[model samples]
Target: MKSLMKTALAAAVFITASNAVDLKVLITDTLKNNQNLKADRYYQEAKQKSFQSVRNIYNPKLTGGLNYNRLDLDVRNTQVVNTAAAFVKFSMDLYDGGKNRALKNQKLYEYKAQKYQNISNVNQTILNVVTLYFNLKTIKENIEVYKEKGRALKAQYERIKSKYDLKMATQEDVLKLKSEYEANLYTIEELKYQKMQLIKNIELYSGVKVSRLDTSVIPDTNVKYSTTSDIKALEENLKASEESINIAKSSKKPQLKIEDTLSYYRYSDYNEKLLSDLPDKQNQLNISLTFNIFDTSTKSKVESSKYIKLATASRLEFAKKQAKTDFELARQKLLTQKEKIKSLQSAVDMANSVYNTVKIKYENGLVDNITYLDALSKKIYYIALYKQAQNELQIIKMEYYLKSGIDYKKLLSLLK
Candidate 1:
């Protein structure tokens, strides 16, 4: 009997290993096909383009205009004059109290912040996929446990029915067994439905249909916490806000700019004869410095920006604290799950021993059907508990890895 049990265990292990799916492949596919991630990629591209646009603040701008005029005088009501002129102008910011440079830096920092945010989004989506995959895997395993219990109940029911026919058991015993069997069937059906829903959720997030998942993938539970993408993104945001303060402060300084224009003029012979000394063509270069001696709004804007910078700093501090709290919580939960798994494994062993003893006594007619059935139910319940605890341990480990910001590829490499 021990040899047979060992053979069965070995076969189950072989089946599990044979059917194992590569977690790396699944994660890669999820990253490629997830709609939210694709949308975030487009958003990141937009931010990049905005950064490029901001960097062109010093580029020269060209503008052109044309004008036509008609003039009449009461003293010369019968006479009319027409004039036309056109001009092309070019202007660029020679300096704006460094506001342009600060604004450009702010956009660049914002783009960096956006990139980190995208990374955070990707990580969160991957975490969700991993969670759903494992949940489905656990539910599938639970269904098998329920089926095993059903088989045991069916066997017991048949034994009781046979005993009733032989006048050794009462109708009550047969009826009780039948009811338990039906209940087990109902439970199995419910579990199957739950498994289907999990599969649907996984498909929605990953854009891939999942029929099976391997629970053999283990992650390092001893990893230390590192800077998560959230924290980095917040840091960038704070820097960007600081740059904005500089931009606002720059508004209070003098602005120096250069303007250049070239123009052409034409007049009818009648108008030219009336105004003889008018120049027909012109070119001009002007350099101007303007200072805001007492702008009422600049002070208010700078104060508002300083307050925003303060708020951003506060948020950064809060985020750091929250990340640390999450890391510690996940770590503690992992430890607690490990302990639960150990205790439940011992309970499973004891329950199996009791079930085997009850089965022997029932076969020898030393115990009643109800007592035997109860022992068997206890054994099945403990087995399910052990399996659930094992699954929870894996999930907690994954959570720890995520909180620690460990590379998912490294976690995937640990799969056996």
Candidate 2:
């Protein structure tokens, strides 16, 4: 049944849009279009019905029938007389090994587990959607970065051509600038394609078209610059997993149940009456108990659940170790990007100084355009490198938030 629903959802959202829409709008539409959400809701509702399914008082049944006695003896002028009876009987289950009660508990726990599972699913879906959103955001920023570089290079290319016309600049410089401009254009095009692919992923998952995006902001979840935030969340997850193991273990014990029954009946006779006893309004009562001493097949499930719980604990431990490593790596990477930014910032300033001074020299015919253009190009490149350095810093810090469990809404709030 679930596989069929998933297939339906797949067919519904299979097509990608011709163009992208706004991310938030797309999310809203996707939720509306999401057949999977509806399926989850239906399953949850079915689980809720289990509450109403708790064993209830079943009413006793009353039976009625008619019959004729055959006696050809010449009695009562050989008359044909009618005979009828109205009787009530009570029935109850003696004991089915406490299976009903156990079933009820199983259903209850299953319902609860499903609720938690749904919460986890929502969290994961939000993560995927937000990741795609930010992925597009990153690509868009890179596109702008390249566009800025292209602008600078285009201007330099024209200046070099002018210098070449004056026989003051080599063809090599002009060709280099042209090649750089083309490369920047190509980079921009690639970034645009990447951004669209991110949008395509969002559409496939959310089942909505993405039209526009608010890229003026970025996520800045202020993670407690602590040493053990990820560890803390992992610990919580482990505890929950442990409790789940307990729930599964609870299933192995034999179940016990108690039951009772009661009822009444009415009667009448054809031609008033011909019976040994009248329909005697009767009452009934009963009690039952049962136990299952052996089921080798079920033991496997208990063991499997236990092993999964234990594995979760082990995974948490591994994550703790990985977090420590990431902490050190983040520290090193951020420091490197920072030092590089500082170095290149100074370089840009010095290059700008040189370009200005040399521009003065060129105007005075003391030097040529080639020298001035080279200095200008160096300054622009340094500025571009500085932009990359900033992005690298943000990436480093983003790790801190992600490790701290910065979810979509929280991340969105930070971006806002």
Candidate 3:
């Protein structure tokens, strides 16, 4: 029997050790496989391609074509004529009133903005995963507390039942103990359901089935807020919007382009004599200048672009303020949760001492069953509360880290 028990205990220990996952590994896996982050990366790549396309807007273009014509004339005499022509044209925009440059700048800023946006998405996803992971740990700890309470209540109920059989304890006492045990059992079941849901949510986000999560990781509480990706992305967008305004303004300026064409023609008919004056080969070069001097549409577009720039500027300001506000709030919550945890720790210690004293007295027949049960329940409640506070404190720390723009990888590295 002892050998079997030892083997079972060893197996349980081994399973627990094997299931334990580091917080850093969990976060790294989440970043690698998260669908939303992958989508954002793809979007960033597309924006980069668009930026490159914009830079090549002024590349030279070459075009070639062939044409055939046939004619029969009966005016002076019967004549049959056929013509075949081939032409090659090369064209390039030498100047576009600086519009192309502004467009390229806009796309460049947009691409940068997308890169920062991806970073922001990653940060948010990390926050969600960390929060959910810790929440599951908290719920599981609470379940254990309830289970312990249930066990204590069950032992007390058995003792009371034995006393009632000897007419030493009342039936009411036995029923009360039984009721508390049942209630604790119900609470455990509810908590287990909650844990199941949390596990599912974590699996959905991290793309892995997590059997155990390490809660020993701690974050630096002294971290301070700084510029985050959200603010940077908005700043880039503002620059892009400003470039749009410049592009619109440039549309009113003159456009200059150069074109060169080479042509060859062949004629094989009776009308060749009449068409002998036509050149068999020709080359032409042309320079064109176009200016929209009286177009109301260009003016309207310029005004619209300016308005959009203003809006973008407003959004940037708002983002900065929001980031600051979030950081302050998270820091404040962290401080509050820290204090709460300290107080709950003290309470738990006191509750444990009282429960131990009451249990000894009840065993010596110096205290009633109800008193012993109350002491045990108090200990369990305080313990559960303390664990919950600790979990909440960790969550707030994570929020503070995220809001402060601290690198999550660095934060995870601090885990020990």
Candidate 4:
């Protein structure tokens, strides 16, 4: 009982560990190093500048100046235009109410929309990394498959050669098997080179030493792939677009602001200087309001916003229709691929059985070496065909999953 419990605990510990996935971890690492994400982060930080709306309040302007010339302390009848007077003027906004408020509100929504845009972009990046990783994995598996088949053919060819030397088989039979095995070997080499290229691509996307990393994740048959709900996604996108239109229109309304400033000024000569500690100092302050009432340009802006809103609505409807078509299309392709795989599997099994029978006949001296060699050739051909069918089916399945936005993490779990 104690031993059994310990074994169970060990199994549980292993199961609880996150599946060792080099590609997923590499993707996470790459996103951190992504220059685009870094730029988006900077954009997010810049959103803080919107707070200036509250502080840098636009105020009206003021003008003031003085001119003076001392009368000549000289001969009689000499007079100088000498006078000095200072005036303070102020202009303040009393009524163009709520325009600033609209501006600030629009900007707020714009910032939020940008945040969501970044989120959507990040999701796409994740998908891209995952798809590329799987493509490389598929090619790697092909290389292994070819290599294993090649080894089997090599063994069979050696057996045939020994039989031929013993005068039990024709030279033709021996040469044919040798040729097939050599072809398999050539295929293996080709696949190996292709696999090397895939590894290089993996390094390119991940920028990591994948040679030192864990194996990529593979899906198990036990897990299921769920199709995407296009209706739901389209609804969400439409809602976001609606918010965008609202943000655009918000720019048309009145806004609120408050601003205060302090500065020092110096002239060639001055009686009242802003920086001086003297009693008579010069400074000015005012408040103002701005309105965009008669601009014909805003009409164009409103039209564009309305058009975008309409366009989004239309696209959402079209997406619903397109989704239905795509779902059916994928369904048809999947069914076709499955049937093809099934037919090829059956053919391979029948050919294999026929080859075994021919082998028995040749051993009993009831059939020629040509018949036996032909059977084996046919069996091998069928096996290769079956493998190719499976590969094609796998690719189509992947496409279906991608199109439907199916999450395969549970599929990953089954591989363990």
Candidate 1: where are CA atoms >4 Å away?
1-21, 57-59, 65-86, 266-270, 275-280, 408-416
Query: Which parts of model 2 have CA positions greater than 4 angstroms off?
Result: 1-145, 148-180, 198-222, 225-256, 259-275, 278-283, 293-305, 316-344, 347-382, 389-399, 405-415
RMSD, every candidate, angstroms: 4.4, 12.5, 3.0, 8.5
Per-residue lDDT tens digits for candidate 1, residues 1-416, read 99999999999988877676556667778889989999989988988898888797665789999988767644222333666889999998888888888888888888898888988888787777777766777788888988998898899889889989999889998998899999989999998999899888877877876766765555554688899888898999999888888888887888888889998887663634556776788999999999988878888888888898899899999999999999999989988988888898899999999999999998788998789889988888888888877777767777788788776667666654
Best by lDDT: 3
For residue 48, give model 2's deviation from the true position in Å: 6.0
lDDT of 2: 0.60
How would you encode candidate 2's per-residue C-alpha lDDT over 300-336 as one tens digit per residue? 7667767876887898789778876776676567668
lDDT of 4: 0.59
Give a tens-digit lDDT track for model 4, residues 204-261: 6556655433444434232132334444444545554555455455456564333333
lDDT against the true structure, per candidate, is 0.82, 0.60, 0.85, 0.59
Off by over 4 Å in 3: 1-12, 65-86, 264-270, 277-281, 359-374
